[model samples]
Target chain A: MTRSVPVRVHRDLARAITAIENGYASFGDTLATLPARENGKASFVVGVTGPPGAGKSTLVDRLIEKFRAGGETVAVIAVDPSSPFTHGAVLGDRVRMQRHSGDTGVFIRSMASRESGGGLAPTTHDATALAAHAGFDVILVETVGVGQVELEIVAVADVVAVVTVPALGDSVQTIKAGLTEIADLFVVNMADRPGASRTALDLKHMVRESGRDVAVLQTIASEGTGIDDVMVALTAARASESSNAGRAVRFEVVRNIRDAAVRRALAVLDAPRGRSVLERLRAGELTRLEAREELLVYALAEVINAD
Target chain B: MPIKVLVAKPGLDGHDRGAKIVARALRDAGMEVVYTGLHQTPEMIVTAAVQEDVDVIGVSILSGAHMTVFPRIMKLLEERGVDDICVIGGGVIQENDVPKLKVLGVREIFDADATTQNLIDGIERVVAEFGRARKRTGAATPAS
Candidate 1:
């Protein structure tokens, strides 16, 4: 009922998001039609990730309030893990951000890590672009906090804000979850709790040892402490460097291309000729690798022709 | 994509074991379930449901405040004009109270003894019906 106004103005933005999430057949091409870099005001993407229960959601809640107060429209994409088996996700991120529900300046979408090769959902990049097209100034990407294995946000966000909490074991080992490098800024959430200062110091030391000049800030996100500092650090980082700038754009392009290719490959696999190849593989008439190679060769040719 | 459901425990229901279980069941059944942690007001739940664009809301309340809680949630949804969202209640509800809850616009009520499969099937049926009804009325999406 509280329609994010930009979505109303852009008209197609909401429909485009629905199209992407619903897996409309033309979403691959729809990505091409979207405004990529150099075509519109580039929206800043901040990726927030860390261990589960580290208050990433609460941090995001505060960030939304701060960003909204600063007169900047915000969009949030909370990426939750889809069941590896059922492909369904409990996207509880919006629950943590109930404050922004009626704020027309903020738009929130919960996405399942569906079908995408990376930790993010297949439509995440497209969703971000839709938000950008809808005129959101700041975009926040919240990952499912999977350690090490889920660094896909690295390729998507311009600035990655890694969050951690106190008493979360050795700070260095915590950073070992592959966050040691991708973090443009580190936040020690729940700083109101004991050991917060120690955790912050450990993060500072680990960041220094990693040779990344990232700022480590402490925030009691539950009570909105240090949100302004986090905002300042994020803004400074966005202006200071282009760590994942061109990378996010290029990755999106290639991802869309790859997704299109996969869809085409699936279509080919459902064909009679492809079915014969599958039958051969099933009967051991051809090795799995050999059949895969043949399918790839056929699918690639078809993809090129389609292009 | 599967239908998205927001499972909320509005009010002071600290005992969210049933809510959590229902959320997990919905997820396992391939529905996206957003479980709002513990304490929440009707406003918070409705706000979250709208923001998440959920097709169904599975509210679990065992605090014996269903008479007040269910109506408030229904009123909030009505005020927000988000009638497309199917409301399904589950918890310790007296059998005689079922008609009252239904009159308040809850699509269905599930007792504590309801099976996981029953909840899933009921949610799916209501959501499917809502989708069809929306499609018929050209209300596939909420009004902007």
Candidate 2:
């Protein structure tokens, strides 16, 4: 069992997160040393994802309030997209949650989704783990505004709430196949607007046909209406002892191994021997397949030598 | 790693046109800018800066509250024991108040005449300086 020294200082936690984000040399060791939950229950990671302007941030802010009122510390990681051209981002999600800034019980960090396609920053998982290790009872992860197929939240959160709005022009937009599969619950925010009931009913029908026990709840998040139901549903989903935690761990391990191997392969291809193979291929002395095989052999040799 | 900046609008000023422009310029210059929308108190700004672990904070004040805002933000950062994150100011201000604000640890202040490129260049300089100082002092490293 790793010794648990909860990082209580805001500045220290912030620094650790920054280190992790920057991929510092010692960050892997730091993550390894973080204490796991003693009770064997997974940390409560709530992932709120939705289309842009669906009131995800407002809902998260309300959820933070609910969690804080129950004497639970919460850490929110809000993600925004980085401009592909400039590789920069304007993270504005914290605007809605600024009310909780003065509260020591709440910590909010905004991240830019840099070179990641799954609606999250690459370091989101590590940051969530750090926040959990730091003794926050609830870790809320808000993904960048996503379209269908940005279902990476499934690998991080114990409970995934997909928030949407009414009159998105077509009810079919709500039932996108990729998003429906990952949702533990669906929230129709701006429920006070017209067609709220229609959207909720469409989601309910879809959920019924899918035969998953996903709850569809409606909320006017700005007014805090129906948020209690969301809280209740989230609590119930968490308490049901789902396999999400184990699945997330397995997914992370597999992803890490794949990423490391890819990095090693790239390193091998960048070395002198591999460069020679590439030069030969360019000169038509070797075929593309032959060059690929040679590179793979070099990568394997590098890996074996390291061992 | 990209530089992370917090573009905060402090005080009761609802006119955030300038703040938004600055934020856009910073983003275009390849900086990750966190925008805290209108009416942020010093406590809120400091809290956000500490939590985000930003390289610098650019506070935009049009309410003529620089004297009140800059000192409180500086003091809050000091109170929180965060010295490495540089604090900067921009927006409307009397020319005389700029020196006084700088005396309170506001690193640089831009008035109406300063262009976005000037602001970006100024921030890059300050961030580079702070990064060097943190490297020398190891102030940004987490304690084991």
Candidate 3:
């Protein structure tokens, strides 16, 4: 049996990681609880996303070197919604991170997002914390293909980078509309390809039309070009977040603690009264409104008991 | 409580279709699934399995890294003293790896294209056996 532990201790970190992975955090708002020891660990979560063949894995490879050279531990989470189709990525992320395998400071994980919205909820989020809890200073999540659900990553990250290739056709409505806003920085990869410059220019025009302050970068990825500038954009964003001083992260942390407590109360709980009402509903002994009342009482009791 | 599972991606393999599908079907079946996101090492996974206290540890691997990663996880679990937990697998595993895996004590192997129903039924059955084994050891006994 696994005994519970304090969430801030190193040994207990695994237990906390498990709690998050298991959907214990999902039934309520427990996702925001600050560790008992805030001083213990922290990481910059950077999300990089774009369509397939945009050289995200390769960009990540170069980024690792830039971070490691400064003596920072880097954790990479690459989400792939298409497994067999991604054909080479299972090997690519690994091969790219291989040089650091011996360094002990780099941990890279690739996930197939097959379930609804890419099934990234439990896996990628838990993995990020596992890295932060393991003491990494930087974590990168390379989103699987952009989908309706990939938007969930925004909840877990501090900075969002939307990666795209040169000459994306006008047919991509979602990319042009949905992605352009959330992106703090944009990278036009495969810069050597024809029409790459034109695509960047067109994207810039499209973005400018929207009147947003997004940084656009161009990269030839294979030769390790233009990544440093991307890093500069990322760092600037993080620095701004900390200095903004609204303390939104603090509020989130507090909210999560309360939510976790409520959820735990919901579990290990017995609503004999609610069950009896439900049983009445099943037996047609009570109207739906009556059942609703019983449920409301149960929900209130849960919050009270949780405290 | 429904059977709880921890589906983990260990190593560098990025393919997760099977893992995600299994997670969804299991959740739909009323199972509680705790997914340990990708790039898990044997150490991280064992630590997760123990903490989640799942009835089974189902790892979906296609990276050819399974031969090395799986055994490492098995050994890590044994060391952690949760060897009683059932281990099952899927993905493009070679037929030859099956026998060795069974020797390592995996209960069942589901090949590709196995229906979602197949995985669900297999997990339910394994969970039942797991409960029985726990009872035999007097680790936990049900009200019935």
- For residues A1-307, write the lDDT of model 3, one tens digit per residue: 2112232232233333334444444312222332432336568888887776778778888888888877776767776543333211121244444455444456565544433253243356666766575566788888865733345556557877778886677525424455565677889899899977777787777678778677888998789899899889888887774422233365346545655655544552355666677788999988999777666667766667757
DockQ of each: 0.33, 0.57, 0.09
Clashing pairs in 3: A109-B39, A112-B16, A123-B37
TM-score of chain A of 1: 0.79
User: Model 2: per-residue lDDT, tens digit, A2-95?
Assistant: 1222323667777778777876635565554444445554459999998999999999999998888877778899999999999989999999
Which is superior by lDDT, 1 or 2? 2
Model 3, B1-144: lDDT tens digits are: 346567878888866666777777776676666565577787766665554455688888878876787788788777655555788888768899989988887777777877889988998898787642453342221111
Give interface RMSD for all predictions: 5.4, 3.1, 11.3
- Please write out the lDDT profile of model 1 over residues A199-264, one tens digit for every residue: 888888887787878899998888888998999999898787687767667766777787888998
Candidate 1 Cα outliers beyond 4 Å, as residue runs: A1-16, A24-43, A69-71, A99-106, A133-135, A154-156, A164-181, A188-213, A218-228, A240-243, B132-144
Q: How many steric clashes between backbone atoms does each model show?
A: 0, 0, 3
Q: Estimate each model's TM-score.
A: 0.81, 0.88, 0.54
Q: Lowest-scoring 10 consecutive residues by lDDT in candidate 2 chain B?
A: B132-141
Q: What clash pairs does model 1 have?
A: none
**How would the docking of model 1 be graded?**
acceptable
Report the TM-score for the A-chain of model 2.
0.83
